[model samples]
Target chain A: MNLSLTLTINGEQREIVLDDPRVTLLDLLRERLHLTGAKKGCDRGQCGACTILVDGQRINSCLALAISYDGSAITTIEGLAENGALHPVQQAFIDHDGFQCGFCTPGQIMSAVGLIAEAQADGDAERIREAMSGNICRCGAYQGITEAVLDAQAKISTGKERDAA
Target chain B: MNRFEYVRPTSIAEAVAAAGEPGSAYLGAGTNLLDLMKGGVTQPSRLVDLTHLPDLGQIEQLPDGSTRIGALVKNAALAHDPAFAEAFPAVAEALLSGASAQLRNAATVGGNLMQRTRCAYFTDPASACNKRAPGSGCDAIGGENRAHAVLGWSDHCIAVHPSDFCVALTALGAIVEIEGPAGRREVAMTDFYLLPGDTPEKETVLDAGEMIVAVRLPAEAAAFAGNQRYLKGRERTSYAFALASAAAALKIENGLIVEARLALGGVATKPWRVQAAEAVLAGAAPGKEAFEKAAEVAFAEAKPSGDNAYKIALGKRVLARALMMAAAGTPERMPALPASPFAPLPEGVVNV
Candidate 1:
């Protein structure tokens, strides 16, 4: 059976028809949508290398089926930069050197962004750490990543919502 | 992912009916299911997504002073909800302890409850596993038993159920509400999950064609407000399955324990509840010795498998520490437990 779903991605309403269950949201994003920022590292949920935002929540797109997410709003790394300006968390990653090989950068940034949003909504650092700990970077860039997230949090917490916009 | 049918049902009854087929599973947040399908671990013939169903995504308060959390509620949402945090702190803490923020955002309540074991044998098709393929034989019994269960394990299988949040739900007297072809029935959370017993393949009491509509946690009066704690000893600070963990609730009045509830995970095949320990600490002082005695009560019936005896000791520590932490809660703050003696961090407990 086939199903057609309409969703908002990168501020554009897009309709996709899915039937073959083999195609995941990750597959659609990489192979169909042509947004390859969310990489496929360990296709297993063990690695958060394919993280993205589903209605502003960080999720492993590789672990999300395209057909299941028919009408949900999605945001990817490509959507993080508006008017060529990187999102605060992404900028903080650049400033803190949060990545080495950069394979897990997109997922890390997406998870970090979610953590930062959560912290601003009243979560602490330990809570944020627990939340962001799913995206693992084998290059051992955790310290820098945590620092980047904390750094971005400090700015976002005290800054204006317009920055997020 | 093999080609299959997909449906987005709008109500619990519809979703339950759709999922009643031979190889059909309801899609919650798709965190575990999508991974399994992609990794070739689970290949369902159809997926009936429940997220689009409005009622399944809500968390409601029952008139009987219980919390009804929809199956489609995201793990992140459940852990952050104020009412749930107060009534079931162990649940929030357990979810926080299990996956990283990113995964939790995608993980749903039902999917979290129904996640498959992380056993290498069950995942690796080449490796024989009776759970994945009944009568194929479990290679994990003797072959790499490190991450396998210590208690409730038989020669047929040693894989552990991998849900940190479930242990807390078990201790807190939660209930599973399922809508099946037979009709709606609420199973106590403690009984919803069963030990591997002789059938390692059957994990829960829910039958086929049944959909978990919601999980409800009942309310209880408190001694200075009942406190809950979830203590986990995993491979590291993040993103690893628990090695041995405890979910405990304690009601202490004037340094005397009035009521206690304890559940252990990782060491057992199911969310292992300890009624004996709960009884042992019912009237004792809320202190280390009281917790130690309670731990003894729970471990008395435990049978550790080969190479996993360490879990028996670790499970005791987790219980004792969680007990103390819950007992230590003040009128203001729910206390934090001591760190576990086992730290497999900086070292690979399971391949990252």
Candidate 2:
């Protein structure tokens, strides 16, 4: 069954006409919208490789049906940067050496961004590790990833404080 | 994945009517259902999207101080809600312990209850799984049956329900409210999930076209809100299914156990409640001996398979430790058990 869905992707509203109801959000992003930043690692919800923010919450895009999210705003790794400046999380990934092969970097950055927005972890390394447990990096770069999330959280918090001031 | 028709229903009636159609399934978060569909495990002809239904995404306190969590309430939201966490800490912990943060954000309460087993054999359509295809034979009975059920297993299927939240709900005596073509009805959480009896295919007691509206937690459970613990034993600290888990709540007055509620997960075909275990603890002193006895009673009927005999001992220790932790009022400090004995499987092999 074909369904028409209008999704606000990366702050831009895009109308999608799906011929199949089974297409996942990950597929819609990569195949239709050409937002290839979200990689498909497991194609299942087990791996967080397809993590994206839907309405400011991190979720596995591979498991989310594109048709089910009609009016939802989706934020992918590509959406993290604004005005040609890297998001704090994306910058922290580079500063902390958070990626070895970089296959899972987009997912990791997206998850970290979503976690910070949720105000979890609160700059605790253990809490950040637990919060980011869903996104796996088989390259054994967890130490760097943890440091990056913690660093990014601090930067984001400082940025928020400056904005409030 | 099979091609299916999709219908977005804005009301409970529309959802029920759409779901009443032949071979229709309600799509909440699609966390598990989509995975199953991608694996060709389940092929529903139509999907009735229930996300459009208004007023079904709330977590509210009933007038009597009971908690009414709508079926569409996300797991992460419920786990982090101040009132819900204060009222049911163990349940909140259980929900948090399950899946990844990303999954919990997308997963819904009703979807968690309706999730399918994580049995490797059941998920692998190539394998013979009675739950997947009736009379196809269960390969897990003799093939890598480590994660298979030890408590409730018929000759047909030994798969276990993998919801950690449901285990806590069973321990809390939660009630499931359902609305269907036959009107509204309520079923205790303990009775909501069915055992793999002869028909392993039929998992829940919800009749055709019945949709879970909400799960109502009784006000009495709030009394023991501070005295509950959910101990999940898995291969990893997170993002892994439980090998054996215990959800325990105790009411102790002056060192004497006044009431006890206990349920086991990941070791049974369903969220298993052992009234016998609770009975053993009731009226007894809160000590190691009483806790050990309760654990024994909890696993008295466990019939383990070849690779999963360790679960018997593991389940006993987990239950005993959970009881002791609940009694000590240190549920928050309850540590994760040692790595699962079933872990470190061969490469490319997933835990069933």
Candidate 3:
């Protein structure tokens, strides 16, 4: 059965027509919308390759039905950079060599963004590692990933402090 | 995943009616449901989406001092809720310790309670599982069953319920509010999950068409907030299911245990509450002697179903350490590893 869904993807309103109810948000983004930036690594939600922000919270898009997320705002890895400048998290991932195969980097970066927004870690390396435990790096880049998240969180907090001052 | 008819109902009545059908399933965040579907474990003909329903997402403080948590409240939201955490620290810690950050962000309180066993045999369609298919032989009995149930297991099934939150809820005496075609009703958290008897397929007390609306924590359940701990023993420090877990809560007065609440998880078909153990702790001082005695009573009826005899011993240690940690008092802040054994504990206390 065909279903209609309206998603504010990457800060842009895109009314999508779903030909099937079985289409996951990850499938809808990669297959139909051609937004393959959100990789589909273990489509069963075991790996966080398809992680994305839904209403400012990180979730496994592979397990989410596109029809269920209608009228919700979503953010993907593609939206991290603005006007030719990479988001701090994206830059930090590169600076810290957060991935070997770059397969789980998009998910790691998106999860990092969502984690930073939650602000529960407070830039603690242990807390960042714990909070980002959802995303797995098969290439064994957890150390770099943890360092990247810590650096990015420190930068974001320092920037906020400067703005407040 | 099979293509199913998706229907979004805005009201509880409508959702209940829609899910009453034989092949209908209620969709929460689909964190677990979709995984099962993708694995070809469960294929419902119709999905009744419950995400859009209003009034099922609020966390309210009732005038009677009880806290009514809506079933739709996301796990992350509930865990991060400062007031809720302060009132039910172990429950918050259990929720944080479960699954992963991404799953918790999307998973709901009700969905967590409804999650199925992580047993490989149950998920693999080729394997004969009595829990998955009634009357089918249980492959887990002779198969690799190191992580199977120890507390409650029949010849038919040995799968354990993989929920850390339910363990803490059972210990704290949480009440589950249900709405169904018949009417609204409440069931104690301890009684909500059914043990695997001859009919392992019947996992819960909920009849067809009944839905969990909210979970209520009695005002008195908050009394143990001063001394509560949920400790989980997992294969990994994070993002792993529990091998054995314990939720321990004590109400101590004048160096004596006024009351105690204890429950075991990842070692049973349900959140196994040991009221007998609690009775042993009453009027006794909180210390190694009493905790060890209670741990023995807690595992008095436990027996391994398969190659999981080690779980019985591991479970005993988990409960004892959890009680010791609870007696030491809850930490001011959530541990960095939440419920993991690696989290920093009281001085002179060893990891289980």
Chain B TM-score (each prediction, in order) = 0.92, 0.94, 0.99
Model 2's chain B TM-score? Answer: 0.94
Best by DockQ: 3
Candidate 3: regions farther than 4 A off: B348-352
Best by TM-score: 3
Ranking by TM-score: 3, 2, 1
CA lDDT of B214 in candidate 2? 97
**lDDT string, candidate 2, B1-352, tens digits:** 9988889988999999989988999999999999999999999999999988899899988899889999999999998897788778888878888999999999999999999999999999999998999999989987998988998789999998899999999999999999999999999998998889899999999999999999999999988876787878888887889999999898888879899999999899999999999998889998778888999889999988648999999999888877766776633431322122322222322222
Task: Provide the overall lDDT of each model, using Cα atoms, as 2-decimal numbers.
Answer: 0.78, 0.88, 0.93
- Tens-digit lDDT track of model 1 for B1-352: 6666877777777887788889998777777777677667778888887878877788887787767888888887887787666666667778767776777877888888898898988988889988888888988877878777877888888888888889888887778888899999999977887777678889899899887888887756222235667778888856778898898888777767788888899888888889999999988977777788899889987776667888888888778877766665522332222133332221211211
DockQ for the candidates, in order: 0.65, 0.71, 0.93
Q: Tens digit of lDDT per residue, candidate 1, span A13-82?
A: 9988865766778889999889999999887667888988888887888777777777789988899888
lDDT by residue (B1-352, candidate 3, tens digit) is 8878999998999999999999998999999999999989999999999999999999999999999999999999999999999989999999999999999999999999999999999999999999889998999999999999998889899999999999999999999999999999999998898989999999999999999999999999999999999999999999999999999999999999999999999999999999999999999988888888999999999998889999989999999999999999989999889998888788756554
Taking chain A by itself, what TM-score does each prediction score?
A: 0.90, 0.98, 0.97
The TM-scores, one per candidate, come to 0.92, 0.95, 0.99
Candidate 2 wrong stretches, greater than 4 Å:
B330-352
User: Could you tell me the TM-score of candidate 2?
Assistant: 0.95
Give i-RMS (Å) per prediction.
2.6, 2.3, 0.6
